[model samples]
Target chain A: MTAATQPQRTGRVRRVGERQEALAGYAFIAVPMALFLVLNIGTTLYAFFISVWDWNVRTGPRSFLGLGNFERLLNDDIFLIAVKNSLYYTVIWVPLTMAIGLFLAVIVNQKIRGRTFFRAAFYFPAIASSAAITILWIFLVQPGGLFDEIRGALGLNPLFAAMGYGPTHNWMGDPATAMNSIIILNAWTTSGTFMLFYLAALQSISNDVYEAAAIDGAGAWQTFWRVTFPLLRPGHFFVATVGVIGALQLFDQVRIGGGPNGDPNNALMSVVLYLYNAAFIQVNLDYAAAVGVVLFLVIFAAPLVQRRIFGSGPAW
Target chain B: MSTDPPAAAQRPPRAAVDQLAGRIPSLAETEDVGPVGDRSRAWRKRIAYALMIGYALLMFVPFAWTVITSFKTRADALRLEVIPDPFTLQGWEYTFARLDPSIVTLFINSALIATAVTVTNLVLGSLGGYAFARLRFPGREVLFVVVLATLMIPDQLRLVPVYVLFNNFGLTRDVGQYIGVILVLAISATSIFLLRQYFLSIPKDLEEAARIDGAGFFTTFYRVMLPLATPALAAVTILQFQGTWNGFFWPVILLRDRDHYTIPIGLLFFRESGGFSTNWPPLMAVVVIATIPILILYIFFQRYFVEGVAASGVKG
Candidate 1:
């Protein structure tokens, strides 16, 4: 697909250094090319090979299994649960991140006061380690912790009750709320980076459009819907696509937040975490490789499907 | 047509006023009808600003908690009080001095790995990026596409096979694990793409002029291209450094020994070893240590962080 966009080779002045230039070029690219091949491309292909074999690390055993790993993955209940949880994460995480991100971007993009401070504040979490954030979130949601305290102060239990959910409790401890808590934390932490993306896109948008829309008697809401939203489509698309890709690979937060075993009835089980367990915890190297291949396929296909749905646009 | 001296003098000031007014968004474009419209618009702006501040505070809670809890006594940490009743140096002292001398080791390990990864990516990524961006070589497009394709294959997909690969080589056994992790991240697609964007944006004349002056490809790249690409270099360096510092999954898999563990992995080990009843103060203190360096770097280099992030998105 990208090949069509490859620029044509510009005319080069053929000189004594021409042959040497090609040689040096090859030499320059040699290290990264080899590293990419052996570590990235080669290992990716090796994952496929390992998946077809019954490999056990502890006993150092390997036997041909063909598509047996793939077949087994289909019936693997934990793997299936992981798939479901990952989907749930992506579904909730992507839209929440994009909406909040775009909203913050619009706010900061405006000619308002202290935008620099707001932008930095919103973005700080995005730069922090996920593990650290998960720890902080856990502390916040612990019994009588900051989150709980704030929730009580705000009378959020009634709001939850109004939505037919039970009154406030330990968010990470309860299975029903565990994944939801994770979704909230992940969305909150990640939205900052996407906000930066949207901010760039928002700033790139010319002011004339808004002025024109205003002159045409469009209200603020109408101007946003007709002009700003459409113009910010590329930012929305980028943020969403990246968000889904990232959300599906959810492991760090789950591993740290819900505990490694995906505690509370596996509410936070993610495919990557599942694969990690299979390989490291269970010593089933081949099975993990199979899961890896499946993950590769999912990650590969997600962007293509997203592009089809969102319509790819040139991002700022 | 009405260019009277007073009118002309007024004309310039009038144009400037019109520009200023045009720039300031009106309370409403329609006939104001009454002062109520202006008041309501002012109210809306105030509400928007208030919401922005509210969200910023929400985002800051975790950070504030991390900071305050780090100085608190264990009991104080468990309490909902925003301030520590008896703030002490015990947590910081324990984290740095007594907890595990290897906490210091973990910091060193993270620093070493981060530096190695950043330096390697800068040199090799730039070389490959320069080759693709400027050099004429056979199969450049195809090779470039292959490198770009690696970005789509999620790191999880590489996890098991790479674990197996490192295990077979005995890299998972000790300090070799550092090599294992570094090799995995050495040629990041994002870094290469970022550098390629930077290289492409630079004028070709400099390199051409250098070549005409008898400088070969490598020399021209080093002397002319590399110097001009400092901004991209800094951007990618910060990105790679922060990424490696924040890395959790690979470190968990590759480094089994606590001595070899990076900050994230060590923190996980710290958490696991302490279990649920672990005192919060030292834990928070350890997390602060892990976080502070990256936070400082980010605060200083916020501009490049945004640029690198936005540029990476643009590539995608």
Candidate 2:
């Protein structure tokens, strides 16, 4: 009888302990969950709600639009330009940065000296503030600055001149070059980060695979293209997805480089920059919310598109 | 295990095997076409080194130029000299003295805000991550999914609504702006996700042992788990600090007063105030100032930074 009672008491105690554990779990997540609901989920839902209404701080919900703002955005010239520029930046910058990163990673992965120094040098720009980097970029690309000096020294001014861009072409001030300049700056700042990712991926591939390729008489180029490239599939997918998402959110550089309105005919204008201008500078909160919703859709669709392109695999 | 053949007896004799292998021409030795292959390999190495060095220099030139320009006078900065001719501290002096609210104030604000945000993320992220990782409770999977979903939504999507929300709460002013920024950045999905991933990778035995000893849930987490998660905590701290230190968008929007402006916003204001005939030297000086702290952090905590990026598999 005493043994039976002991078992029952222990079971009851275990149940009480389980209840306490559950309570603790709820308590642990309480603050973050609350903040996430209020800040992230709440704000996201609010954004969607306001997108359908003509809302502003001063007067609040002036009228209901019911997708009217999105329709207006579709027809808006600046919005289209912003979208085009964002796409252009993504298309060019993502591949360029990834290639540079992969190349650097491969180089650094080789058993060589000073690889750490080289890695650090390449990554330094990435750690710097974007605003600071953009400011420096503005100075670097100024007419007759270091770039022009290098162009003159390399005897490439004539090539530029033949292409209708003079040696002294204002990189940030020219519509043709403004977006490209921003892309170059971003590539410089981000490639090192992607390089690190690619390096990690490369290091995970064992030497046995390389030896197997070598035994098959594959040349260095062939081995890289056949064995290494395919093996970096996961890295490619990750870099591409993250790059696309980040490129679409380009704002700090454009804002600093081209002003609040993307100067030189909105060439540097990005979707996020447009959203900012719409909300704060223009004080059109509802329109900005609409733009935000559209940007969100594009950002959401990007990874799904990538997933399709890369295909689901065990590595993923 | 002891019942198996002795370790040495279980394997072929090493010297005999080596001798047998040496009798046959190894793939590497057989493939070596004497001088031709050696010369070609040497050439490849040389080419690889050249390409890497060239790219590294390209990656570093802008920064090198920024540093050089910072030492030059206004007129000297515009010159095409690689070295600063007639170097001066005028730029640094001007940055400290002439900037509204002063550079020191900007640094303090950035440090304070970043510290607060990092600390909150460490505390809340660990708690949430611990619960999601080790604690069993209803809605665990759903809540984890919700946290990840938040990561997909771009900050721009929530910008307008969050701004309006803050404005309504009277948080878009002075110290309130700091509080607002902290609140928004307090506990990121990335932080929770990273910590959760780390916590999940830890063995269950430790927590189980603590539980069997009659330690409460909070005590086990605080005593046994938190101390064991130092590496993950370090990663989160560095990532959060760097992110907040360099953050531009929210600060630019929320912090209107110069006194409350973070470094990025201050840099933007400095650039914009220069207008058409911008003072490049002084501006570069401020850029250097803004970049130095992050550079120092990266140099010292380089491992943690790379680990953070690898762990998150996302851009900071």
Candidate 3:
């Protein structure tokens, strides 16, 4: 047998094997890609389709009404309230959460005793379910509950009374404070996770920078503002972007804190909650889809605008 | 009244350094002191430690409240009491016995759904991730970008249409409820991204050897890459488990049947069905039950959780 004959046979087998390998790769990815198409991409298109129709699940018939849902959403007062409340929530919650997160990150990143314990304690709430935390928070915010007692004990009630505000009202029942109460609970629960992000970013910074700053006679505050904050840009951008997205989608806490309608003049009405209420409670599918579309546009645009303002590259 | 214009905000960083000059010689007199700078450093360390303790206490308060309240009697729960006088097991007893026996069914449903979602994510997510990471084919980059683009689309935008899609398939009813949720959460964009990052870090030399020995693509992925990816697998499993377990919005919409209710939905039902006379103790009991499993998982998998979160944050 000639050596050329053997070489040719191996070459052909190798080519066939490579082809088989490529086919296997395609096969491996097919299932996830299929699920992605049907569940995520296909349904997104279908959402747009349903938004333009008088689609009723119970009635089993639909008539096309082009841009009718969109037109109505523009004038819907409760929908406007939902949008306003969502914006309020985001505006208040994002900075509060970030500030607390950064503060805790700085603290825990220190080379001190029991730092691990401090980290674990802070992160414990982040691991617990939002439903459970909301339930606990509801307990605390009710009349004669823990929060009211604490506020009274801290002399805050007397101060409010002096200002002609009521003493120890139900925090969740009062429209003025219901949204703020949710913000407090959310900031407490989520800052732990965000603190970990800041910690990760902090650890990645080389110690040489701190040494250089110290050698330059920079004190604690100067070193923080000049070197530390600038280097944590990725952490800041990630936290802010994700925090805004999460705040805008605030639903579970609102739903549990108030009813699905976000009661008490709908002060707690978030856009997602409003969407759910319209679709399910009110059986207004088209309106719900329109609301969903608006929310999507807002959330999609927020990040791009923030990037323009911050002049930062992609967070990651 | 003297107006001090927020000295903390307006103070120069060098002010503290200047103040330290008077105390420097005294610090220098101490035999153990290395330098005046070291004394300032010690003072800074003390401040950091104090802040850490205060913040840890702040984070721990909610958790402490939950634990105490969950053990309180109904009357005690309604009152502003820190410690229940007769700390009762009646809440735990009633929650386990008095609620619908199908509360157990809800627990089982949650476990099954979380496990199924985790398994699907590991299998399908890794498959797609591997293909993206290690395989080469025509149009791969374009297809990968398309997949990644879907990640930016908000789940709320998909809610209405996905609910409709599931309704169309009759999965919103009792029969296919669990399977429907599993399908919805089957392909996690973050997990795929995480796994792809991990696979890219692995060297190709081992796979090259396997290929020379006549092993195929699937075989190399299964026998070579996967075994080496244990840490990433653990991270994805932990993150997916926590996400699926704690998911509320989609599950509530999908599983309308009482028997198919997951933990969060069941808690909501427990409140609604109980109406005005809903007992606080048992409600808190159910909340405690729901939270413990996740807390336990987090405690054990804390490292993996951090790694997974850091992975997403750094690479997103």
| Chain A TM-score across all models, in listed order | 0.90, 0.96, 0.94
* Better-scoring candidate (DockQ), 2 or 3: 2
Interface RMSD of each: 3.7, 6.0, 6.6
lDDT of each: 0.81, 0.85, 0.80
Q: In candidate 3 chain B, where is summed lDDT lowest over 10 consecutive residues? A: B1-10
TM-score of predicted structure 3? 0.90
Docking class of 3: acceptable
Off by over 4 Å in 3: A1-14, A58-61, A162-167, B1-50, B80-82, B274-278
lDDT of 1 by residue, A1-316 (tens): 4565443232233553467667877998899999889889988998898889887775454679999989998998998999999998899889988998887776766556786789889988888887777787887787677776776778887886786555446788888889999999888888889888886676666668777886898766677778889988777777877888888889998888766678878998899889888887787888998998998888888878978887875643
Model 3 agreement with the true structure over A1-316: per-residue lDDT tens digits: 7886998999999787777767887898899988888888898888888889898875533898899999998899999999999999999999999998888777667644686688788887887777778887887778777777887878898887786556567788889989999999999999888988887777666667776776686766777788889988877887888899999999999998888899767989999999999999998888888888888889889888878856775434
DockQ of each: 0.41, 0.41, 0.31
Tell me the docking grade of candidate 2: acceptable
TM-score of each model's chain B: 0.88, 0.87, 0.84
Q: Residue A208 lDDT in model 3?
A: 72
In the predicted model 1, the residue pairs found to clash are none
lDDT of 1 by residue, B179-231 (tens): 98888888798999988877887767888899789887788899888887887
Candidate 2 residue lDDT tens string, B1-316: 1221222243345444334323222223335667888877677667867877887788778878888888899878878777777979898888888878698999999999999999999999999999999898889999988988898889999999899999988899767999999999999998998888778767788889998898989999999988877877888999999999999988988897989999889888877774513888878887888888888889899977876777677432
lDDT of 1 at B290: 84
